[model samples]
Each structure stands twice: as C-alpha cells, then as structure tokens.
Target: MPFAVYVLGLAVFAQGTSEFMLSGLVSGIAEDLQVSIPAAGLLTSAFAVGMVVGAPLMALFSRTWPRRRALLIFLTVFVAAHVVGALTPGYEVLLATRIVGALANAGFWAVALVAAVSMVEPAARARATSVVVGGVTVACVVGVPAGALLGEHLGWRSAFWAVALVSVPALLAIVTSVPDDRPRVTAPTGASVAGTGTPTVRAELRSLTGRRVLLTLLTMALVQGATFGAFSYLEPLATRVTGLGAGWVPALLALFGVGSLVGVTVSGRVADARRSAFVLAGMVSLMVGWIALALGAVSPAAVVALVFVQGMLAFGTGSAMISQVFHLAPGAPTLGGSFAAAAFNIGAAAGPWLGGLTIDAGLGFRSPVWVSAVLMGLALIVAGVIRLVRSPQFTKATVA
Candidate 1:
C-alpha cells in the first residue's frame, strides 16, 4: 500500500472524530447552548442525514473533477466547518455547521474509497481500503474519549477546537502526498468487463438501479443498523447489567476499539481472497455476540469481552461489504461506494432512534441488544436470499 493511503486515513480520522465526538458532547453542548438534551442529540442525526443526502449528489457532482482536487476541496470544507462550529454563538448556527461538515465528510468518504482501491492492485484493494478505514478505528479509540475529556476540562467548544486544529495536518498531507492524475480503472474481481475512466453520472445512476446493487445496499444498511442500534446504548447496558463504574466505560470503549482494529486487519487479509466467507463469518460472530449480551446479568468481565467481540464483528466486514458493492457495479465503483456510505449513514441515523424507543418502552437496557439481534437475524436471512437469487445457476434458470 502507498503512503498516500495513510494520508487518506488521516483525513478519515479527522472527520470520523468530528462525527462521533457529538456522542460524548451531548451533555456539555446541551448545558452550554441551553437546549434540551434531546435537541442537542439532533446534532448527531443532522450529520448522518447530511451523509445520506450528500453521497449520491457529491458523487454526481464530482464526476469530472480530478479525484485529488475533489478530496482536497472536501477536506477544506470539513475543516472550515469545524472552525465555524467552534465559533458559533448558538445551537442553531452550530447545527447548521454540523450539517455542512457532514456533507463534506460524505464527499471525502465517497471519493476516498475509490481513490484507495484504485491506487492498489486488484487483489490488494480490500487491504488498502481497510487501512484507510482504520483511521475510523483510531478515532473511536482515542479521538472520542479525548474530546470528551477536553470538553470536561475546557468546555464543549474546546472539543471542536481540537477537531479543527487536528484536521490541518490531514489537509496538508493530502495536498502533498496525493497524486494529481486520475486512477487507472480496472475491472473489479467479479465485475463484467466495461469501459471506464470512471462512469458518467447517467451510467452511475443506472448501475445503482440494478437489482444486485440495490439488494447488496440493503444488506449493508441492515447490518449497519443492527450494529449501531445496539451499540448506541452500550453505556447504559454496561451500567445496568454489568455493574461497571463510569471510569471503566472508557476502558471498555478502548477495548472495543482495539478489537475493531483487529477485526478490520483480519478482513484486510481475507477480504480479497474470501470476501463472501469473511462477511458471512462476521455476520455470524455479530449474532453470537449480540445474543450473549442479551442473555443478561453476565459478570462485568464477560460484558467487557462481549463488547470487544461485538466491536470486532461490527467492523470486520466493512471492507468486504464495500468490496461487494464495488463488484456489483464496477461500471460506477465510485458511485457504488457512495451508496454504501449513504446506506451506512442512513442506518447509523435510524438504528439508535429505534433502539432508544425500545429502552423508553420500559424494556430495559438489554432490550436494544435483543431487538438488534432479531433485526440482524433478518438481515442475515436477506443476505442469504440475495446470494441464492443472484447465483449464476439461478440467473441462468430464470433466463431459460
């Protein structure tokens, strides 16, 4: 993998830190901005909504722009939004900045995925993608906690200040390290041969409309929803069921982050050669992990271990999922990648909202895990169905 992959990863770390820090800042932001906690919570939703909306639009808009130029533009937007967010006087302006930031974030993700894969050999694409995505793991492990700590000591605005300051290096790195020319397009592992320099917007839209592409996108959405729906409530689950101290929460999160690193690294190794099996295995691991959490009243150590295992499973299939998305519509791999980002963000927005409802319904902290498990099981079934129906023999029989 090229050093530019690390640069892209740095960019991902910057935006991802911005994206997740809101979870840790809700209380601080609510207090400082004089908004209801629920209203402050909307900041997270606004970001996710922007990601979903930005993906396809940005993919279409950036079609003619050189990939490096598009990336630099998006990073500039991301960093500038953080500055605006840091200086905002009220919740409304801050919310607006958050949305703008997320739009830039979505664009970066869409372009970055294509750039990463295109920079690598066909067989190494998944591994390259994993390295870029690893930035997200680092953000989760260190960035969110550090932001929370900063907020506690220096106030919520300080956290945004930190994000804005940290983003500078990534922007500079991209300007220096990323190549100016467009990537050479090669056929995806399973994609039918097609002309490419990257598809036109019309071709991109057509590829997105195909049955295989749409189904795979749905699979991506459900799996992501199940993961976040349960994970968003982890703090409460740990406190109520596992009896861990608030101090240990960070440790738990850190352990989960470590497992995420492990999982994605493993995926990097096998995703190219065994993408389908890697994904299936991760799905099964996720189911088992969620089930264990739902079984309830486990020892604190056991709960910690389960969260680590869950994080591993939650992140393990990322490269494989995106790889499949690319293969399903290689004519527009960039747009296909954008769709995956959109689906994941849409799920990130919806999952916790649904999980929150279950908790509010008096089902207790463990309910989200059980609810998420059932939803994940449904996703697993759909994946199987899609696989069966899209198999060569099935397609041939249908044609006959």
Candidate 2:
C-alpha cells in the first residue's frame, strides 16, 4: 500500500524491459554487429547467466549496507549498464554490457522483493509482493513490445537508449520515495531489516539448501521451464500454426500479459492462507492450458484462448511461490527470495533451449506446447509428491 512499493515496481518495469527486450531486437543486433544470429542470441544467454549468479552475490556483498543505499547502487548500476549497452561499439563489448545489465537487473529484483516485504506487516507481505511482481507482467505487455517497435524504426541501439531514458525517472523516484534502512532488528512484531542482526549470508545460504527446500526449488524450476518452453516460441506458433498475421503477435503477448496480471492479483488475496493449494492448483491449470495449446494449435481461437489461460495459470502461482520461500526460511528471507529467482532463470534458460531442441528435431512448432504440458505435469507431480512424502519432514525441518 505504500508509495515506495509502487516505486520499486517502477524500477522493476525498467529492469524487465531490459531483460526481455533483447528477444525482440536480436535480429537487428545480429545484422548491425555483423555477427551470426546465434551469436546475438547469446547476448540473451549472457544476461540469464548474470541473473543466475547476481542475486546471491548482491545479497552477500550488500549485507552491510542500508537497504535504500543498496537499492540506489543497484539502480544506478543498472542505468549505467543500459547506457553502455546503448553505446557499445562492438559485438564483444555489447555482450559484456548485457551481462552487466543483467547483473544489475538481478540485484535489483532480489532487493526489491525484500524492500517491498520489509515495508509491510507479516500477513500483508504476499499482497505487497503481488504489487511488485506485477511490474514484470506489465513490462511484458508494454515495455518489450515498445522496445521492439523502437528497434524496428530507430535501430536496436535506440531500444537500449529508450530503456536507459525511462530508467532515469524510476531512479529518481527511489531517491525521494524509499527511506534509508533502519538498524537491523528481530522485533517481536517480526519486523526485518537489512544488515548485522539479520542472518549472516553463509547461514542464509546453508539454510535454503536443505532437502525440502531443494525439492521446492526443483518444482519452481520445472514449472517455469515448462511454461517458457512453450511461451518462448509463442510468436512463431501464432503466425505459423494459428495462421495469424505477424501483427497479431503483439496482441497475443498483450493478452497473455493481462491474464498474468489477473492471475498474480487474484493469487495474492489467498497466498497467505492457502499457499500449497494455490501453487498446486496453478500448476494443474497450467498443464491443462498447455495441453489445450498442443492439441488445438490449428484453431486460432483455441491457440489464443489457451495462451491467455496459460499466462494466467503460469504467473498465478508466483506470489504464493515467493511467499512460501520466506516462510521456509523466515530469518533469511532475502536469501530465500533469491532461491526462487535463481530457480526461475535456470528454468528460463533451459526451457527455450529445450524447446529449440524439440523444434530442431523436426517435431515442429507445436512440439513446444507438448514440452510445456509435460513440464507442468511434472511440476504438478512434484508438488503432489512433496505433499505426500515431505509434509512431516518439512514440518520438522522448517528453519528456525
């Protein structure tokens, strides 16, 4: 409910734009740099790799700083990375800039969740988180497409410049909106803060790697991998399989974004009381949506409808998933948060790679949907098994 929470959301919009914009601009970048298309695609891969490593590393190094200061540092660095990305002269330099931008992007994501939750009461954390996570859905709907359009008319560097330009205002918002972190505390009210009394970075890392936690992380990875496997190739599926014109790709993406926004918003309302059930139902619904896409891609209406459902079902699980991490390691909430983030990118990187392999095998575009369905099914099964097998152990092992 605080204005600062929305400010952080604004920051995420800028970060998410940078994260996904490369997908749309890859071809133009390849041509401009005189590099192979695959090499340009590696820029996206570099960003993912940075994100996978950056969150925990940021948590480790920034543990001693005020949260507000840390956030400013992250945002400033992110803004600079985009500037470098916009101005870099060669392919190799651009690749490095992508990595740096992703590092800053990942760093901001980890801290922003902590920042949002820290501003709210325990019971309200999930709802607060939805407000922050909504930025990504909104970005998917708005930023990436706009960046793509800019790239088409003004060249790829202009898209990077556009992101950098938009980010400056968000950066300024944080300066006035977010307060400096208070001294660390473990108050009876369950107020958490940055630094010192907060669990040490090592302990936080150790606590989240337990058997139950690892299983949960795996479930997160599977769910995301499955979804991205299909969703990554959505434009092609829309144009090639559904027989839609190229212009419809943006519309399809926007519809999916709207569905995801609804999913996260609705899920936030129940996450605290029904976290497990929420995630399980989401995975099940996602599986059904993917299956529909696979079996019905030839029907344009079916493809469009199923994608909307898939977007809703897939993102519908996130608020609960994220809140569950904090529950699992209450003392090390930020690190726990990072666990979910890392799992997400790992799955994100793997999903498209797997989907690509499926396509290369001549399984065709629809095959990605099959991949999505299977992954979601596995995630559902994993959730089921964890419920059946790990309940007692999880109850006993929840980090104190």
Candidate 1's C-alpha runs over 4 A off are: 182-196
Candidate 1: Cα lDDT at 315: 81
Candidate 2: which pairs clash? none
Deviating ranges (above 4 Å) for candidate 2: 182-196, 393-400
Residue lDDT tens for model 1, 253-336: 888888888878888888899888888888887887788888853578778778888888888776578777887777786687
Backbone N/Cα/C clashes per model? 0, 0
TM-score of 2: 0.93
**Cα shift from native, residue 90, model 1 (Å):** 1.6
Candidate models: Cα lDDT each: 0.83, 0.82
RMSD to the native, candidate 1?
Answer: 2.9
- RMSD of model 2 against the true structure: 3.3
Error of 1 at 288 (Å): 1.5
Each candidate's TM vs. the true structure?
A: 0.95, 0.93
